[model samples]
Structures are given as structure tokens and as C-alpha cells.
Target: MRIPKLASVFLLMACLVAYLTYVKWHIEGIKPALFKVPYQHSGTESDDDKQTSPDLSSDRFQYGIMFDAGSTGTRIHIFKFLLEENEPPKLSHETFKAIKPGLSAYADDPDKCREGIEELMEVAKGTVPESLWNSTPLVLKATAGLRLLPGEKATQLLDKVREVFEESPFLAKGDSVSIMDGTDEGISAWITVNFLIGELNDSDGATVGMLDLGGGSTQITFSPQDKTIQTSPIDYITSLQMFNRTHTLYSHSYLGLGLMSARLAILGGVEGQPLGGSQELVSPCLSPDFEDRWEHAEVVYTVKGQKAGEPVYESCYNKVEKVLYRKVKKAEEAKEMNFYASSYYYDRAVDIGAIDENIGGVIKVNDYSEAAKKVCNSIVETPQEHPFLCLDLTYISVLLQELGFPKDNVLKLARQINHVETSWALGATFHYIESLSRQQMTEHTGKEDKMAALSAQ
Candidate 1:
């Protein structure tokens, strides 16, 4: 307890040295270890990855809902997108559901359409996150089904849909629900295929064509070679600009040439004109032994085959020829371009074993013709469960031939690309985002210009 002064001073110096060392270690090592976040680097992160990676404070998933109201049914497409600040949005997931008897069925009783639209919106509600319900865009685009209806009746149904959209929590902007022009329908489909295949932004990419066969209309769209555009009819040529590239495409949507509509015409039943009660329409395309009632666009018809006569294929071809002859404009350019056919084309091919239902395959125009001939010839010996199979096959064959596709021309039949249904909805969603982005950019530029002028003053 009674230490010398020098010894006590040395003990104090030693204690002071220990304290400084601890402070230095804490500042240079322990504090940094406590506060710094360790990054596990697997590889270099891409610009896209960096942009789309979700911020801990903000969710980056965007949702869009689109309804396709065709002649046969109404379908809902709920798409989930991963959005980046300065990059094109990526489609991360999609939910698709459909209900029968299209919106056109409720044309006369417009009020009845609400239930169907509401049913679809419920699906959207379940698919998207509840927090994003107010920000998700909801849109409905009607095709030829409504286009063929009486203008007033179509308007009434559209107005009813609009009211339903307004009541929903999702964003419903002007033009949210409307009849899509046939040309727009074609272009949208074209966009879907091109975008899904990653060809939109490629300067040297070989873009594929699209063929969509709906109940009431068929669309063909593709970017033709420069010479093809030069020789094509001005009416068949459409200009599309995407990703800052201008594409002059051979795109057209033929009304009344769709499988169902063509069937009506081939059977000699006029659209919108019912043959009153009990009067039957006869066609050679059907099995002579077959007779049934077929319904379309809310109209029922007594349909049957003509009494046995010439060969089934010959007669059926003649009937189908009458339906398509000189009606659909042929795009000579399409013959050389590779095309992807979907909708009824895919369905019919699947029905006949021409393509796989899940993984579609390639088919030639001749394959359809041969299948048609076989189906027509066998109709008499063994009736098909679906009597219209013969007629449908024959019609598809003749339709392709008439459209300038040679018998040898190959078509890829696909119901989906990258697990997403091959249709116009995806394309429509992309277009909507592009439009919004452009508008925002324009506004931002205007604000910048204003600020600059104010600063100068």
C-alpha cells in the first residue's frame, strides 16, 4: 500500500497505454465489424439485376389486369411484373382465367354483364397483393364479337363494363374498356409474339409472324421484307414503332373469316339473320348422316348435312371455297415468313393430333387439308362426336391456301410461349406501360425546361 512514487507513476503509464490501444482497436476494427453489412457475391450483378432488385423499404413488383372479351368467352389475364427504374419492365408471372358465353351474349340485357365482369375482377383481386389493388391497371378489350353487334347494343354492354370497372378498387383510366379495332388486334398479337421471343430490341433480330384465329376474326401480322412492303397493298401495310424502331409490317385482321364465323357462312347461315324457327340450313361439309342444332352469338340454328351426293371432301372443299374465295386478302409475303399460329389454330391442331396440346409443334397447310379429307370421308362411315370437325378442318385448310400460304408452308402452332398464353394481352400491357413512360418523360422534360427558363430570368 506504501509504494514508491516512481513505481506508481509507471503503473499509471501502463494503464493509460492499455486504454489507448483499446480505443484504437474499437475504431478501426470492432465498430466497423458491428455496423457494416456483409455482401455474399456469387457473381457480377447485371445492370438490370441491380435496377430491379427490390429495395428493402419499397416493393418493386407491378401488377396489370387485362380482360379479353371474345365471341366465345371472356378471359382475364393478371400479370405480375418486376419493374426497374430505367429499364423495360419484366413479366414475372401471369394468372389467366376464362368464363363462357362472351360479353356479347349480354348485349341485349346489358345489366347481366356485370356478374361476369365482377367474377373476373374477383380473380384479379385474389391474384394481386391487397396493398396494390388501387394501383394496378385494369383494362378490357373487346374483339370482333362486339364489333358485329348492333352499335347501340355494343355500346350498352361496354358502358355496363365501364360501370363495373369504376366500382373496382383497381385503377380504371379512360379507354379502360372498349372495342379494339381489328388492326390493333393484329398488331397487339404481333407484339406479343415478338416481345415474348426477345426480338423487339434486337437490331438484327429475325422477327416472327403471328396468326390468331378467334371465334369471329382472324389476324395475320409480321414485318415483311422491304420488297414485300413495297409490293403489298397500302391497306394491308401497318406501321409499328417499338423500342425506337419503326417496323412496316404486313398486318390485317379479316372479319367474318374466323373459324366460327366461317362455319356460319359455309353452312349458308347469314350472320345476325336467323332463319326463323324450324327452317334448316344444309351443308355438304357435314356428314350426310349427321344433323344437329348449333348455336352462335346467342342465335340457335337447325343445321344438317345435305343428302348424300358427291364425295365429302370435294363437296366440303367447294363449300369452304365459297366461304373464303376472294374474301380474305392474300399476303404473298406471309408465305416466305415464319409464322406462329395460336387460338383456334392450336386447338384444332391439338384435336386432330397434329400438334401436342402442351408443347405445340409445326404443321403444314397440307396437313390440314389431308386431315380434312380424312375427317370428311370418315364422317359417313363413323360419325364424329363433334360433327363440325370435318367442316372446321376443311375450312382451315382452304383458308390458309387462300391466304397465300402454299401447301408446303410450315406454321408453328403454340398455345403458349415461356409458359404464358400466346395472345394479345401481354402485348397490350407492354404498350400501356410504354405510353405511360413516354407521358411521364414528356412531363419531366417540360418541368426541366421551365426551371431553366426561371433560372435565366
Candidate 2:
């Protein structure tokens, strides 16, 4: 009794060491990012609606998590249903926090890459509301940056993320982290914008087309009916995809477009032989219509000071306009030369050639005023091919018919409803859930499996 056994003492010391190590690691893993209060900005359900009750059993969830891993950063958005019964969750109520430890951080080692994802997950989890801690679904998806990374790094990183976050009871258990395809990411981007514009419709009577132009690739989707794509509680339009036609909406990512466009427009057409340099003064065509173009350019403007003085002109274009003007002149020349050299490029130069041959080149010639009237009429009356896709909505409408959406109702919805570009995480999660439920059904014979049992009935 006076002395304990040496073996027992050794075992006790090992246990103490293990406990301390776990505590240290856990504390170190805590992320500092804070979650903003998830509050509804519009269309929130009213708590006082006594007739309506929160249907926790509904297969559809209003609250979930989306992780967007892009080239420059990782953003985790928490979408929560802040409304009470009888109220629909406002899509705008979603809140997010982003970390800049990009996918390139893991360019060398899978372990480091895994750490980046884990860090984001930790930060996201820590910031969400305590009430949603257990019920919120987490959808994880990576962008081209992550997916395009070669070697075992991408797969290993995914496995490690699954190992770390899958253990959390808060995450929907039994499902792995979602991995997105290029098409899914494109769809989500469109979805986000479409939802922002309040254009998602709930019906099978309409269809829509969506287009998403990303940094590396472009995504185009066509939905035929509103609910054919998924068995989601919401009445979402559905359609097949048109992977072959990337140009239906005329989106050309071309690897360097975003950066090159900015650089050329800002720096005067690269060095050595242009307007910014000597011996290059050819008096490029500076259009008098430049102001009109500027007004239409997509740019974020800034006001130097509130008026009291003459309007402080601080358009972002002002910084690069002159340089861009020269570049545009050069571009026109380049295009002409390129066209002159390549017969294929010049074939479609005229509108008559671009029109479908089936239409027999019915080029409707009209006077200026008549042309304006027709253009406006077409813009207003054209039927949508998909209702949910709003990005480049006009272009999407054309794509929808090409993608096999129904002609009348489908096109109308596509025109009227906004589109949400796809999310890799959400789509992957959905596919995974579908697969999982299928597996569970196959494995279970009893009534305890809720999803399977319901299906069986």
C-alpha cells in the first residue's frame, strides 16, 4: 500500500501527457474569426403567426453553410433561417467571413493545404450562432484553384478535411465534404446573383438558362421544367446541360482575360511599342463616343467629396481611360489583321452570316427609328429559357433552347426568373445526400430508417 507499482505510475504519467497535448492542440485550433448576427433583411417569417408552425421535419432546410474556395481566398457563408413560423427565410440574411490563405498555400504539401481548409472550417464553426450549432448543414466545395491542383495534394487535402470536420456532430453526419465540378461552381455564382435579384420561381411551368463567367472557365446551364432536377421541397426549374456550347452566351475566360483586360486598359497596351512609349504615336482613333461608352462600362464609382462644389468626378475609368483609349485603337487594328489572316474568324463578321442558316438569313432591314423599336420590343418580349438564371439573362435565354428547355413555358420562366449559378458544395452535398439515402435504403429492411421508410411507403 505504501508504494505504487512502477508500471502503474508510468501508465498514469502517459495519460496525463496525452490529456495535456489534446488540450493544447484543441485550444490552438480555435479560430478568431467572428460570426455576425444572422438577421433577416427582408421576407422574414413572422413569429406571431400562430397558425403556422416551424416544420423541423421538413426535408428541406432553410439554414445551411456554404464554403467557397476561390483562387484568392476562402469564404464561408452561414445561411440561417432567422424568421419564425409562416415566414420564408430571406436569401439576403446570409452572413459570411473570409480568409485569404488561398489554395496556393497548399501548392506544395497536402498537410499544409489541409490545414488551410481546417482553419476555415474552424473559423466558420466558431462564428455561427449557438442555436444553430447542431442543426446547420455544412456544404463544402472547392473551386478551380483547388480542383486543378495536381498530384495527391487535392485528394489528400479533401481526405484530411473530411477527417477533421466530419467528426463534428454539428455537421450532417455520415456524409463526406462536398467536392464541386466546374459546372457546379458556375451554376452557384449565377444562383447567388439571381437570388439577389429575387428571380427564383416555384413552378414546373417555366424553364431558364444561366451563364456564369469565372476567372478560369465559364458555366452555362439550361433547365427544362422547374422541378425535374431535384426532389427538393422547393419548386425549382430543371434542365439538362449544354457542355458543348460555351459561346451561346459569348463568355470567354481565356485564362488571362480578367488580369490582362485590367492591365491593358490601365497600362496602355504593355511596354515597348505603344502610345505610352516613344515612336508609337500614330494618333490612334480616339472615338468622340468615348463618354457614352464610359457611362455604360461596368465600374464602381467613388465620390471624392459630397457636392457643394461642382460635381467631384472620380470614376475609376478616369484613372485608366486615356491609356485604354490607345489600347482599344491597337486592339481594333489587331482584330482587323487577325481577321484578314484567318478566314474562319471573318466568316461571322456580318450579322447575316451569324444568323442560323435554317432561318434563310432573313435580315430584316429597317430605318433607324424602326430598328430601335424592334430592338426594344425584342428585349422586352423575349421569353426566358430558365427562371433562376439571371446572370447574362439575355444570353442565357438563347442558350436554354439550345440546351433542351421546353419552348414556351420553359423559355418564359427562364426569361422572367433569375438564375443562381451553381455551388460546388451545395451540388456535391446534394449528390452525396442522394447517394447516401439510396445506400441507406439498400441496407435497411426495417422501418427505423426514416428516409428509406418513407420511400418504401
Residues 402-439 of candidate 2 have per-residue lDDT tens digits of 32232232111111112222333333333333344344
TM-scores, one per candidate: 0.81, 0.41
Per-structure clash totals for the candidates: 0, 39
**What's every prediction's RMSD, in angstroms?**
14.2, 19.0
**Global lDDT of each model?**
0.80, 0.37
Q: For candidate 2, what is the TM-score?
A: 0.41
Q: lDDT for model 1, on a 0 to 1 scale?
A: 0.80
Give me the runs in candidate 1 sitting further than 4 Å from their true place: 1-59, 122-135, 448-457
Q: How well is each residue in 386-431 modelled by candidate 1, as lDDT tens digits?
A: 7998999999988888888999999998777776667888888767
